[model samples]
Target: MAGGARASSSSARREVAFRRATEADAYELARRMFLSGERVDMQALATELGISRATLHRWVQTREALLDRVLGDLADEYFTRARRAATGAPDDVIVAVAEGVARATIASGAISGFVRREPELALRLMLRDDASVRRVLVGRLRGVLQDVLPDEAEGLEGFAAATVQLGLLLVWPTLVAGDEPSGERVAEICRALLAGARAGELSGGR
Candidate 1:
């Protein structure tokens, strides 16, 4: 009986894994469609997944919500690559990582295509204060700052938020006016802000 119970438990675990994979497959499918510049239609996704629209809705809530998750995942990937490739002192490393991410984002065909195809929707989704993409980007930067400047815990959140805002502002002209986005410019501004923040911190938060 004990052996049988163990077998049943293993089977149950397998079933759970399968269910999780199904859910992940939904997300992966949606992400792929987005990357391919396809509009993520719930009915189409459900038909492709062989699931009901109700199930898709239950899994991702809404189309905008799913897009938010997809954008967040993409932003996280950019941050990961930037952080991995960064070198130098903590401040310089931070600046480098920001520049790398900004450069990659500006150069991404998928992102640029999405912005060009649906300029208003793309801008609104990305620039909104409550956007998941913005949150993920800011959170990633905050984690890096916390890791590199543990003693500046009191100010890291604000610093990260401000830095991301600055990057967005720089990228705005590219999306709106068809101007070029400069990652080097972002790095320069980030470096200056970091220096100023550190100076203020050292001066007792003045």
Candidate 2:
């Protein structure tokens, strides 16, 4: 029993380390891109981390999976910054949530760029059932919205999902086609969406 427990604990530690390493490598790659305005290479990242290409390949499984894992870890900071920037009235949570959505759209631009350059990566990040990006986002949003919008919480899931779609759409021109977008445009759209929800025009999941 003692041996088994020790083995399990060791395995758990290794798993944790591997996940952290993946995140680190992914983040460094993103930082390089953010700093130098360059591109990211997964295989090169694996080589830098002293891991077999296949090992890193298995860890990420897909290009966007690796990138998403990197960006997914930034949710906390994103939420806070968005909440601070939010404007408008109505319990504050309304603007707070809208700001969160808008901020997410901006922050995700790089990751979306990866997807735009490689549709395969986008599919991995979004279309898969076990996609870590979506899973992390939904879980984070659920936690934040749970108490703040309890009366409207039941629909938060769909609302969050809608936010994701709208974010992509808002960024599509830039992300998919290298076109720029204004925050005012993004905020305007989000305002309309929130108005719909608050006014009970968007129904069905209620």
Candidate 3:
């Protein structure tokens, strides 16, 4: 009985270790796949990771789920860096940040590749209401606008919503029509939205 108990305990420990290792391994590989501008092939990923397809599925559940988490993480990193680098007056800061986002998008081979390879999926994930990627971007951008537009606090939410719409408009061509993203266009649209928001605030919150 004593020997049996020891074996069972050892087995449990090994199982726990395997689960942890699997989680880390899956996340790292998926992130690398995303950064390389390659669509993740589940079977190929499993082979590359030296794990069975069942094991990869067990770790990430579904390919869409994995993509969502990876994209969310990437957006968080980009938005965090942009916010950190932001400076100057509120309007200038937001315009600068928007420009940063545009530049990053235009430069990211991963993003462009993903769009080119999976246009439908990319559009759905980027534009769908329930998508974690869109939610993360909108939430981050909204928080920044809210913090900077103190005078227009009451209308900040509306302003943020509109700003996100503008973003969608600017990026729509790239995601849908496979056109190259334009940083200048992003800057122009964002500047117009900010100016409009500020004007509305000046005009008694209209």
Candidate 4:
């Protein structure tokens, strides 16, 4: 009965795997595929989930929308981790978090792989007005700035925007030229901006 027992165990394993794939929602499956450096193909995803293409389309609308969700979720996770890991004065904390996120993004194989594979689509999705990924990241930074620099409340939005822009600039070389991105430079530039803002140089002596 040893052969019978082996067959039963194998069947159980397949059942468990099938159950996991069926249980995961569309977004979760998409995110898992994205993080695995696989191209998130809606048809393949639907087939794996045992769902119809119509159902998948109704759930995510478009591939771009699904990718936006995946990227936004990753950005939120990275930002949260960076914020938790950062320690220092308020300004320093902000800089650390920004740099940490930048470094993590640069090092992410999934992110870099996607960018290299589809530069135009990646740029369009990330830089579009109302892009949810950028909004999520900027919102997180804005919340932190509001907490740490309440006195500069009037300029915090602008400051947070500038910080995100700087991060994009720092990562651009890697995304475009296959060169390494510099988190240290990001921190240095952010520090300078913070110093200028604190000195009332950025907002005309606020």
Candidate 5:
């Protein structure tokens, strides 16, 4: 029974790897089709994968679902790797977070570009309360602020974190200017907001 269990585990790993390989191929073809400014035809992708369209349909189900899988997975990978790449110094966490987010925003051009190509999808995803981007922002960013504002204990840090994430969308051009976005500027404003909030210095508040 022990030997059988080990064999089953090994076989499971192999099957996982093979399934990932197949998905990678399909993802690659979809990306290329998306990049070419042509509609992603799952049928062509299935042909490339040596599977029928119905089989591809069984695998990914729909074009939107496949695109969602590809883009969402890419975001996760980028966030994971970039977060580790951060220097993680006490004072510099804000800067690291900003750069990390900037990288993500730029990397998300793939999805954003796709959104531009299809207005209806753009309206669905980018406009009118996108739960996807919100979830993505809140997930990775919780850590960045948690590390950055240790002094502002009692969840002030969490507020700052939320502000930073949402602020990027609200005032993006000013917040992130050119190749070298002003992480310092963002940090300064965030720090000030936190400080002011604590001291009851804000003008339009309860």
Candidate 6:
């Protein structure tokens, strides 16, 4: 009986060791799964890591939290690239960056596929306040706009929020019904909005 108890204890130790998961490890796996157009199944993730669902939960909170991290990482990547690729005056730079983001997102097969596969989840996670991805996106755009138009930074949040909402509306049709990805349409719409914002700023907040 003592020997059996020892063996069980040893097995428990091994399981505990095997189930230890770091936040970075969980995020890397989740992000890769997202980029590959695979469903981010928490059970499968835990299984792949040889860990229990409870362990994954401890490492990354909940499934929604893990997804929020993965989506935020993906958006950051695209937004960074867009900012780097942009060049021009304040208005032009904002427009260029916005256009870059629109094109990159619209062209991503994985994002499109994920949206098509899980429309309801996408809408909730993206448009709702429960997820941080949309807020992170809007915050980043607001930061860029503020940088470009420092004098108008006081009221830029509302404009940035509206821009995010409008962009999502434009892309919803494509995501829901497999409509063609129209980068030009997004660019024009954003161009008009940004230009109008600039013009408003110049015209005493009209």
Question: Which one is best on TM-score?
Answer: 4
Error of 4 at 178 (Å): 1.0
Q: Candidate 2, 173: how far from true, in Å? A: 3.5
Ten-residue stretch with the least lDDT total in model 2: 30-39
**Which is better, 2 or 3, measured by TM-score?**
3
lDDT of 6 by residue, 1-206 (tens): 33453455344434445656566666776766676667888998777667788988999888877877777777788889999988888777777777787788888776787788888877777777545666777888888977888887665546666666677777755677778656677677777776666566322211
Looking at model 6, residue 185 earns an lDDT score of 75
For model 3, residues 68-168, the per-residue Cα lDDT tens digits are 78877877787788788989998888877777776776676777778888877777776666667667777877778778886666655555556655676
Error of 4 at 104 (Å): 0.6
TM-scores of all candidate predictions against the true structure: 0.80, 0.61, 0.77, 0.83, 0.55, 0.80
Residue 70 alpha-carbon offset, candidate 3, angstroms: 1.4
What ranges in model 5 sit over 4 Å off? Answer: 1-24, 31-39, 88-91, 107-112, 126-133, 146-206
The true-versus-predicted C-alpha distance at residue 120 of model 3, in Å, is 1.3
Q: Please count the clashing residue pairs in each candidate, in the order shown.
A: 0, 0, 0, 0, 0, 0
Error of 1 at 175 (Å): 2.4
Q: Which stretches of candidate 2 lie over 4 Å from their true place?
A: 1-38, 84-92, 100-135, 155-157, 203-206
Q: Which digits, one per residue and each the tens of the lDDT, describe model 4 over residues 69-165? A: 8888888999999999999888888999999998888888888888888887787767765677678888898788877777775654466666676
- Which model is ahead, 2 or 5, in terms of TM-score? 2
Q: Against the unseen true structure, what C-alpha lDDT does each candidate score? A: 0.76, 0.55, 0.70, 0.76, 0.53, 0.71
Which residue pairs in candidate 4 collide?
none
What are the C-alpha RMSDs, in order, of all predicted structures? 9.6, 9.8, 10.1, 6.9, 9.9, 9.7
